[model samples]
Target: MHLSKLFENSNKSSPKRTGETRKLFLKKQIFCILYLEEHKTIADLCIPVGVSIPTMTRIMHELMDEGWVTELGTGESRGGRRPVYYGLNPSVRYILGIEMTRKYTRINIFNLQNKAIGDTLQIDIELDNAPGTFIELKNHINQFIKKYKLDKKNILGAGISIPGLIDKKSNISYTYPNLGQKPLDVVFGDLLKIPVYIEHDTKAMALGESWFGLARNRSNVLCLNVGYGVGLGMIMNGELYQGLSGFSGEFGHIQMIPDGELCDCGKIGCLETVASGSAIVAKAKQMIESGTNSIIRKLVGGNTEKIKLPVIIEAAHQGDQFAIELIEESGSYLARGLASLIHLLNPEMIIIGGDIAPAENLILDPIKQKLNKYTISRIRQDASIFISELKEHAVLLGTIPVVMNRIFSDEPYINNIHNFNKS
Candidate 1:
């Protein structure tokens, strides 16, 4: 299906007949239409959004009055008068995306077209300190908005993506035990005062890739996030498959060895314990402690405590034999896990994303080599594997679609605004 058509069909709903309905209603329509066909006529929008010609006419007038949309030229008619074309103004609103991982947080601002309008900020904020962590996050977002001089009223919403289990129904992150009694959205939204949306970091990345990156126009895609942990995000039949409680893609905890290395989740032989960045660093530390003597020792310069994933990747890139060995082993383990996923899902494509993907061919080559041997040749031939186009920023970009879905889906936010205006 055409990408724009998919977006438009996804938003087939009633016309919100209210003056105070969040401008997002119009914003979403404009975004969907522009993204789908680069332009749309009022009649085209009326049929898709389930509104009559008159309602669409009024909405378009309001959009123009608010400066959120503008009238382009006219479309040639089949048997009637030429119809006027409309498009999103592209300058009236923006979206902010926050990608949170176990190791770092990145914030970005984007225009209606999903183009980065300003700088992206990265910070190291540990999940262990929940209260202080979001406090710092709030400060960062406030500063970002101030720095860009963006109007909060014109901001659509902020989407936050975090690693680990997320209860989208409750807007709470269950993995951050430190947060104790509060839902993440409640806390973050109170501070931001605008709508705040939260999503599993991996799923967000998958959505990001599906909407604007490598997975575009492809259904049944698998996104692997190789970061501080390993995660999987599945897009099946052109929709994100968040099975049973929105925790489907917990690939990191999949058992690789019956009683192998221990994981922070208290499970034995979990894939992440041996394949994630943290796992790689732990294995490297253990090897160094065993007195295996290599350039990694000198790279750390006797401070074994400072060994990190990037340092190891760099060393491997620089031809450090031991580092290469570590990455190869991790890649092989990852391949074993992916082999199982391929057999079960039969995805059309598998995209490797997250921080570790930057290692590029160094890591991907081993994964491909191992999969060639592990997966059934038939399934292997059907599936193609490639690095993610959005890389580390996929989660943040994914937030755009998340918020768009929320606004356009059958939800109370838009309904309440419409109802309020009617009353």
Candidate 2:
């Protein structure tokens, strides 16, 4: 499905013209440039996006008048008139980003310049109950707006990132059983009375990295989300490469040990079962249950229910032999999975994200050791592997780009900005 049609204004009475479309395209192009750079003159934007000087002037004037862009002093004159630099007026517009996982949901508010404006709120949410879940999310947004004293009019829209297969064309999440097969945007848009954008959590992370993190200039980067379940997000040729049906990055479900551990996805011996945080915790519990002497028993204080990823990481940091072994084992399995990814995608960089990345050197070292042993020397030498720069906030920061693309479509850019200002 064409993205343009999803956001097409149903009230338009006439067909769009090439000139109008070009103007709209320029608007988006300029916004992206300003977002990436702190300040840029009209001449800088014109050269890169391939627009004329007169066209840039018109677009800049419209943006400035609509309170979306601001003049940021003059630039060096190259034997000509000094060019005025312009930047996105971050305070004039805001975006709400929500990143949902099985254990919790993280929410953040960012402005046009992508600077976070308020304190991020992390809440525990149960995905099993859809109605209560959305209600809680709605309340969180309302409270956040109230806390920040933000005018609803200034909000561009909200972006929701969920783990699982997302049909971007339909905005539906197939893995979220409670959401059924309905498009998430349609449901959330109706409830919030604002344009809502939905994407796979890992894909959103990849976009986040591209826009504001280490992968900014690098294409063909792979973002691996190591959470309750491992997932992959691919950035190929400078675009988020969501495969057919938008469920491309299911690397976790890739079979590693056939007929071994059972996966929640109804698959046996999937990579996630052996490599994810849950897998580590599960292995620790099994070892403790078998009367093995380990530091995890003392760390959890004999309470199996309290065992978590952070606890295991902390124990490993404190030189707990058993905890270290568990993490190293999981890291080995993760490297085995990544080795296959290296052979297939030939990505320039591989980033490990999500909650498990905080393990830092302990997990990273084992992963690198196994990769050196398993992968071809050529691939290992070229592809750099590291933890995510955004750390735990990658998915939350990703929401800004997603919401902007959905709400600020080709036509009616000014109108949308005005609507936001008036709200």
Q: List RMSD in Å for every model shown.
A: 6.6, 5.8
Instruction: Write model 1 residue lDDT over 355-413, tens digit each, in one string.
Output: 78778888899999999999999999888899887887788899998777675566334
What TM-score number comes out for model 2? 0.87
Give a tens-digit lDDT track for model 2, residues 329-418. 988999999998898888899898887888898888999999999999997888998899898888888887787655544435444433
lDDT of 1: 0.80
Off by over 4 Å in 1: 1-31, 35-37, 41-61, 71-85, 297-302, 411-423
Kindly give the stretch of ten consecutive residues in candidate 2 with the minimal lDDT sum: 1-10
